[model samples]
Target: MSGFNTSGVLSVAPARMLVPILLILMWYLGRLHSQYEPIVTSKVSSRLEEARKMIPSVKLDWPIPLAKDPRAAFNSSKLALLIEARPLPHLPPLILHMMAVIPPDWRFLFIGSNESIIGVSRAYSIKHQQVIGKLDLVELPPPWSIASKEDVFRLLTDSRFYDEFLTDVEWILKYEHDSILCANSETSVDDGLGWDWTGAARMGDGHFSGYGGLSLRRVSVIKRVLSFQARFNDSEPEDEWFGKRLWVLPGAKVASRFDDAIAVEDVYMERPMGYHIREGGGSLDKSVWGDAARRKEIFEYCPELSMIMDMKLERQRCPDDDGNGDREMADVQVTTAVLGEGDDAKALPNDAESAVLPPQPPPLPQPWKVSVTTFGSPLRTGID
Candidate 1:
């Protein structure tokens, strides 16, 4: 009887010990799972919310003229400013400066990444009706919203946002403006980096083809280009695409001329009247060049005539009371000299030397006016 009791007690003792050990193991696992699950859930939810916020609520009033038509509510005489912004700190002031350069009849359309910036832009548009038109703000979807982390990471680093922005630009052109003047608000030019008016003139005449800084055109072209629902690859740069298209369009013309004395290199140069600061820290050349070595090669090959001309023109136009007729016949002379001499290209200054380009002329005492005319029946049906 004593032996039986001892064996039973020993078995019971082991069973009690095993039960607690198993329970503890289960508790530890449950606690770990609970802790990690919430973290994963929160992270995913945050990303989703961010993605949702990035999509702009699009409101389109259609039947708007896609071509330059006299009967259209918006006229061809007006200019359309298409600005691509991406959460840069300096954009508001840049927009203000742009407003100062163009005619009051011009309209401003901004496309970019952040909704906050768009909100600020809309406010500016309302306050400066004489200078701004219907503000079409298009937000890019966040990078992480995609199923693949690789795609999300690629989008975060790549020009996918800019490419999408271009699509928005095409849409706006088809529905709103008669044409678009795609300009960079982020680049500042010096004698070494300004406009190549000669190149521009030559290109304008039909030899080479390009568009940068400020390009002007009509809406009919945009509609035709986008009708196929063609999507630009993220690898493709926006300016190059625009340049190629503008070069082929019939009746497309440039309103500004470049000259040397005007120091088109200066942001304050009277000719450009307004200047763009190449915001978002990436090189336009590098973005388009594809390879670092190739980019360097092209940068070395090209004379920085465009930058020089831009500064000179800005200097010439800055002092004009009205934004119109700031061009001087000397512009052609300067351009001819720069292109012919080749010496001027060598004379172009470095970034440090160019930094001395004069300050902007005193802010126009009055805010520049931007006026917009909206036409067409408002679209109430299925829209993207």
Candidate 2:
């Protein structure tokens, strides 16, 4: 106290007052906390506010499981392939129908040009098939061409093609736009899985007659053939080129004659699994489709052929024509009359032309009628 002034005098009594003030502040804060606890913990009544509170703090995207992928359920080794460059009108429906009728285990592949790929992929059903993995539409890149028949032939004959694009493929069911499988066929395609190569018969009695329009082929056997043999460009068709060697290839089970035919092309059998109408029936085998009864049977058996083949209604036939391939020759009597005198009168053999009775005009000449005898015969036998 002697060293300090009045400002520095001892203040222990003031310090003693701080404890009560601190206690009062702590008690007031405790009251404030207790009073607002219910409001902070109360359940929200507004739906939007509740939803906001329930939402995840961090955003995330997850995939939903809907339809099953078809590839998981089917055997991808068995491939049904259709290679086309032109976008035909019937492609979408035809492809869908084929998928429906073929074994469910089989997967389909459509290899086409850009235009053709776009043409078919536009269909809702086709898109659905692609989504389900039941089908795939592909357009090959450069150094490969399918714009012509010869180009396709070259493609099938190359071994690199199989290695590059057809990995793990064991079998190939090749079909064209003009070809169709009979939904009513008694035999399913699975029955012929044993054969290395089988298709439409070219000739009734040929040693090797497996036409390629609609065919089932074993990839192992094809690869075996391609390993040692190479196809000449633009020479023989791919089917025939392979067929000739496949027939001779030891252990190869190639279809021969009409007995083993898988489809109907030039030769007719009781019931074929399918039909390969060349040019969509424009070029038909007479022995197979010429007879009226035979055509009726074919149409009755596979009415789906009408989907791709060009045909006329039965009522559209000529009036005097018969159901048979031949048309009946009808006798047409044409009459003509002439007018004037001398040479003009001679021109008209009718007696009315020579008569100068009242000054009446002569009748017009009638056009000559053509009598068609027999219709041209249909193609009997050839390679597809």
Candidate 3:
């Protein structure tokens, strides 16, 4: 009995010691779990934060910026002036094309009548150009008319016109709606800026043959001439008036003949910077634009000329056409080729008095008509 009692006491003591050891083990395990739980939770939280950072958030109040003004990149002194009272359909395109071909440092101004101004400003491209400060549209008041060629001449010759409208302008590129710059031209418009006046050369060797249809003029030289001489009203055209004085004006670097011409008018050049088709080719010079081969070459070099010049399709050529772009009137066969029912198909005038009839006037030349919509969008004129 005593042995059994001692064994029981030893077993009980060992069991009691095991309970405390188990408790210690459990406390150690709980402490380790508590330390690792925060680490695991932090690792998960950090991963979630990194994932959230990968996605972008939207801000409702962000504002979009407008396109930068293009005129800031250009020289304010160089101005392109177009004065047209006629609401020509080609004005917007002609202006835009010129803007593209001319140096970017030049600004454009259109001083036009209400009809013409409205016609031009209706174009979306023209609106964009205005928004960017590259162009301006103005309607001249009374006593500053451009209704006729005489009126335009008077306006340009007047010194007050320049003082009022063109102050601070050093160079002026005067272009008509019928004129256009050739994109394929090897000579840039900037090269012509060196001369005081450069334009299409006239037919003869007259001094200062800078025809002003698509001409570049120096304002200082023009001001000098205007200071001393006033153009006689209803006299020669403004270009000629300026040319006559400009030739005699001291130290003016004017284009004298074809050698210095920047544009083609009556004379022909290999690759002129631009072309001035007078009255949309109704008054085209036979020397420059008459030859079939030369016309073909010009068209190939500058296909854009077709947009401004009056042109006929190849199939529209008259049956008796001459290769030189003219028809030999005497050689034309006006007689009916079809024979009558019998052999009495002799050539005859329809009326007995037809032989004595007065000569009829030639048909009016057709203008090259283009819709403003056809030019597609305005050229992307953003400077890189």
Candidate 4:
């Protein structure tokens, strides 16, 4: 004890205690840093918010196909066009242009957040007054607000929004704000988004590819994905999030060569069913949609551009057709498909087969009631 100085022993004991104190202080600082960092906090907050979100625990199984039934009703009702949007001057035109060209019969549900410039929808509806389709602009409130691109969480959970917006509607096409259907798009016999509608054999795995823009989702599939999307933690590149989340399902499949996503065969190779306005520096790199100078080039490939902003609410009668969009689109579809009955033609025997009247096509499917809603403001669209 005499050899070991008492003062030295006391100093050693204090040093050991300081080490624990420093560690405790460091742990507290680490959390404080995490709280202030927007990126770090956002990730944690989103996960927590996602956890708080209420995705129904129910499982949505694949609905049986009614293709064989003559009475089989396709999901023509409420083709909810869920347009992802942000605050952009061009947003209204983007919506209007596609609306003007695509069949007016389709229902449209616009999904945005507080940051999104969704006021245009109401303004357009008020100004035009004659546009059809139940155009609804919905700005989700906080904890559910998904109006920004960074709000990938909201987009992934959109099925829940759709659940509230669309009732009894079987199909929902989630198109980004930057997307628009080709004014003259079409699907030939074997060219329906890589689906013949005959069997899953031809269906492309859209879930693997992130082309949520053109992918058509049946409500059942939507429910399945929404239920699963809720439990999913990884949320980047929303389209791929859906692709990875939904594709694993028994019947979930997406087929498209759309940009910003993965896919099998290019569904509409050189000619996409729709257009995506994208940034530069990528495969098939060309400024599209967003570029003003290059818009002419885009128009060469997509006539829909010509219709944007140029749309007038008054019905302009087509010389060759009435002002009906469905009828006009059918003709355009037949013309653009480039192979509506090519297989039928090739299958025909070298000799003429007796003409058989194909069973009269069932009465045209009745159109569903279209409804559009806007938060923070009312969304009124279409002529009664």
lDDT of 2 by residue, 69-160 (tens): 55766686899999999989899998998997899989999999999999999999999999888899989888999999999999998989
- Per-residue lDDT of 156 in model 2: 92
Candidate 1 lDDT over 180-222, as tens digits, reads 1123312222221232221122123233222234333333454
Please provide, for model 3 over 1-384, each residue's C-alpha lDDT reduced to its tens digit, 9 standing for 90 to 100.
122464465334567678889999999999999989989999999999999999899778867665485666568799999989999898888898888888887899999999999999999999998988889999988778999999999998999998998887999989988888899998887788899998988877657758958999999999899898988888999998888888888799999978798888888889888888888989888888778899999999988898899887776666557778665544222454457788667675442222222345679988765444424767443322
Question: What would the per-residue lDDT of candidate 4 be over residues 38-150, giving only the tens digit for each residue?
Answer: 98878999998898786657787999764553212323454546545456555667666656655555655566654454456556552352243246566666566454455
RMSD (Cα, Å) of model 4: 31.4
Ranking of all candidate structures by their lDDT, best first: 2, 3, 4, 1
Q: Which of the two, 1 or 4, has more TM-score?
A: 4
Better of 3 and 4 by lDDT: 3
Those runs of model 3 whose alpha carbons end farther than 4 Å from true positions after fitting are 1-73, 328-384
- TM-score on alpha carbons, each prediction: 0.31, 0.71, 0.69, 0.45
Q: For model 2, where is the 10-residue window of minimal lDDT?
A: 350-359
lDDT at 165, model 3: 88
Candidate 1's TM-score = 0.31
Clashes in predicted model 1: 50
Q: What lDDT does each candidate get?
A: 0.38, 0.84, 0.84, 0.49
Candidate 2 stretches greater than 4 Å from native:
1-70, 335-384
Which regions of candidate 4 deviate over 4 angstroms? 1-76, 82-85, 113-118, 122-133, 150-152, 188-212, 228-234, 256-268, 279-298, 303-384
Could you arrange the candidates by TM-score from highest to lowest? 2, 3, 4, 1
